[model samples]
Target: MSSFDLRLLLDPPRYPANRYAPLADRIKRLLATHANVVFVQAEAILALEAVAISIARPGRVAVNVVTSPYGAWFGTWLSRGGAGVHQVSAAPGQPIDAAAVSACLERLPQVDIIAAVHAESSNGALNPLAELAALARSRDALFVVDAVASVGGHPIDFDQHGIDIAVIGAQKALAGPAGVSGVAVSARAWAHIAASPDVAPSSLSLMDLKRNWLERGRLALPGMPPPLEFWALEAALDRVEAEGIEHVIARHRQAARASRAGLRALGIEPWIARDEAASALVTSAPVPTGVDAHTLIADAARMGVELAPGYGEIEGRLVRLDHTGTRAKFDAVLANVTAYGTALERQRVDVDIGAAARAVNDVYAAR
Candidate 1:
């Protein structure tokens, strides 16, 4: 490799401590929280695991809300840490209902922790966060939300909702690098983590991060930080601030509305039928009769459009389309919808591609 390439990849200096604080502060601003924020030098799953490790232990009762596989993983992580976990699971490809969560809290008043995913991209479903958070508060339980996919696309008021721990990633609506993540911990959540004897000094320990935050401050990171990811996150935040967070959210909403309408016009209704239950970032639609999801996806790809299939068990049954961050634009929406409609036409499925494209443009123009 050339010297320039080597210098760019390996010779970069360690990031300054002052540089670190601004990133964390920007992330805190994005979360709309005054809670303690810690930037983890790994993917979001690690930060999420740290939250689970900090709270799960014997005698602690946790209610895990399962809308998708990520929720199931949270319950498993808590269980492995010896917490008594009761999972409130929704039907496959469906968002968890607030009623189900309320019932769980009512039946198990001893529940001290409530965990849920705010929006699941895998199934394109959005859980009732404010309702669930209210229930958690009424039950005096600490509410933990995985807002990885919802952060920029949806409005999240961590303090208003009484969410004790909110974990977010850069790869989704933020349109940033995936190598780093952050978590906002409320005072109550920190207290629990600080008091928990099960909380260790491992990489997945929130208490350790807390200690690092206190001693090193924002200028200094705990360990060797991924400078590249940190810089990427900072750039992404700059773009978000430039566009205004609320406008970004509105764009995402419009994208979701247009995408769903276009898909319906192409004879494929979104999987999350209800508007309230659908996620702004992702829209999953059922595979039409006599057409496999893989075939449909391949057809779209041949038209220069890439589409994601349903995750895990739901694979082959649904086609997943994303409209988050940079993708939440008129051109991107029009392109994806046109590609899908064209693909269906290739399969001899009748669809008005022009009309579908017009629908997307109309929504963009309306807003």
Candidate 2:
């Protein structure tokens, strides 16, 4: 390629300041949200942390659900604000139990906020968002969601589900860049945040964000907005609109189903037995007894297939075959299962690679 092309790659044109508002509008469409959506210049974590710091305060009690490290982090943030946090946790590689969460909330009549992650990429588990939201409704608590991993892979109707606050990233199923993210804030949530003594005019403050960027006509970000992340995010939005959001969701769902069938052909059952409880972005299976997940992951990588080991507490206990974003295709699914089978066979475990590949092919074909 010429230097002109290289320069274009190396030094992209300035992203239009006028287009920032439209980007937030597109995000609203993507999220199926009726709330005021704020475009955050940093990663989804920034938006998530902003919610925690801006709203938490003394005398506020929240029922924070814990399924992965991210959920635990949110609880910690809530506590740093001097709020009393009651965590309802689930075991490794499992989704948060809705009944358990309801029970916990019932014990605490003073609860004013309910926090939960919509889906945990770490454990490959999808929580019951509606149930959690209902619990919040019953208690009249602010319902905040860490929807980073589930936004595009699953249907998250923010308004329909009564979500007070939600954070999203484009890097996962949206196939966008990593640096930029968005957050949807409801009117009720905004009022509660304004009442919080913890609220201050900081970069992490949603109050500052709304007062500066969002309210100022979304003209230009306070700092020099990154051109590359913004432009890539716009292109991602274009792709999602062209494909239709429903189709994008269906693509991930089909990928997960195919992964499950292929893993079964290789004689490994999926970690989460039910389809609803599992994440569509990745399919996780238990590593056979005495078989190391990291070793299998390395072996699969040698075969040109990228496999992920379970996060944190479940590390080395499960192998995750990700079909996230562009990888949610038939070829990628086939390669993932076949490579895993090859690795298992190398470890002296019997596996039918051909059968696994065929299983993936058949599933996609049938769909």
Candidate 3:
């Protein structure tokens, strides 16, 4: 192909071709079969809006169990959609127990939708989705999950888990560009939307998208999408399927194990007390005594190892390692860990560099 033609093919159009049906189909195939899925322009926020609108009624209540930053924002969106919102807050490093959620449901029998985060990127905590979904199912509430960071990094069986509406974005574990996001909607969720009296905003309406793209053929849509992004997403999904979701999840597990082992060997304790609750895609560690996490991260960036500083109240006190995306290669991880050890040594923090390397190597060898 000519350079100009390649450029044209590479650019995403201002409007989506087929009003995003092609991308939607790709997402549907990635998610559980026999589920009604939708593709949207806005991120998980849009999906949250759709879910909230679908379940909202004059006296109906929605419960948002928050263990991460995104869940809090999603709670706000739910409230604005005209539902009575109840929040169950958990500490950043801990996962909210399913028993607690069930208890909440018992107390508030009017809750029609139960929203939770699958993997919390802010504190590297992952909630027990299977348990939470079972609790929601027992309560007869629509289970809405924000799996943006967890879907590709971990195994998410939407149907098996009773996830009625699951939202995901492309930028995190999917390693795709921004501006595209997806949602897996169960048949029950569509029924809820169909029965709701509230009218959603034209562009943000899931029902409208479903009627236009899914019920009606794509050729009938008014505008066309950017073929490049659609094609890119298709290719990315193809790559993920080729690698196998199980293998992808295993790789993330290996990365997390290596990271935690290395950090412990360096006398660094993970922020989350339980290793099982922590996500494989990222890890958070307390700053060493006499060393500021913000300063260490800044210094590490200069050494070509970019580490995420802590968020919210933990800022400057914790360091986070994001092993998500295409950059989670074993070699890159080893290099980053070694660089961190070297940085700590320069600051007079005693670290056995050999031990750190060995810890990571041992994890890889065992696998």
TM-score of each: 0.95, 0.96, 0.90
lDDT of 1: 0.86
Q: Residues 1-367, candidate 3, lDDT per residue (tens digit)?
A: 5556555555455454454565566676556656866666555666666666656766668889988667787788777767788898886556787777777888975768889989877778889888888888888988998888887788788877888888887777777755667778888988887876646546557777778767877543424444555566776777787887677778887888888888888777778868888888787777778997767887788888888877776677677787887756587667667777777887889888899899888988997
Shift of residue 330 alpha carbon in model 1, Å: 1.1
Candidate 3 clashing pairs, residues 3+ apart or interchain: 13-226, 15-225, 16-224, 16-225, 17-224, 17-225
Per-residue lDDT of model 2, residues 1-367, tens digit only: 4556555667889998888888898998877887888877899988888889988999999889999889899999999988899999998889988999989977886989999999877768999999999989999999999888887899999999999999999999999998988889999998998898745557578888878887888888777788999999999989989998899899999999999999899888899988889999899988899898889999999999988988888888898889988888999988988998999999999888888888999999997
lDDT of 1 by residue, 250-347 (tens): 88899999999888777667788998899999888777778767778998888777888988778888877778778988778877888877776777
What is the lDDT of every predicted structure here? 0.86, 0.88, 0.76
Candidate 3: segments with Cα more than 4 A from true spot: 1-25, 198-201, 218-224
Model 2: runs farther than 4 Å from truth?
Answer: 1-6
Q: How many clashing pairs in candidate 3?
A: 6
Question: What is candidate 2's TM-score against the reference?
Answer: 0.96
Candidate 3 structure lDDT: 0.76
Model 1 stretches with alpha carbons more than 4 Å out: 1-10
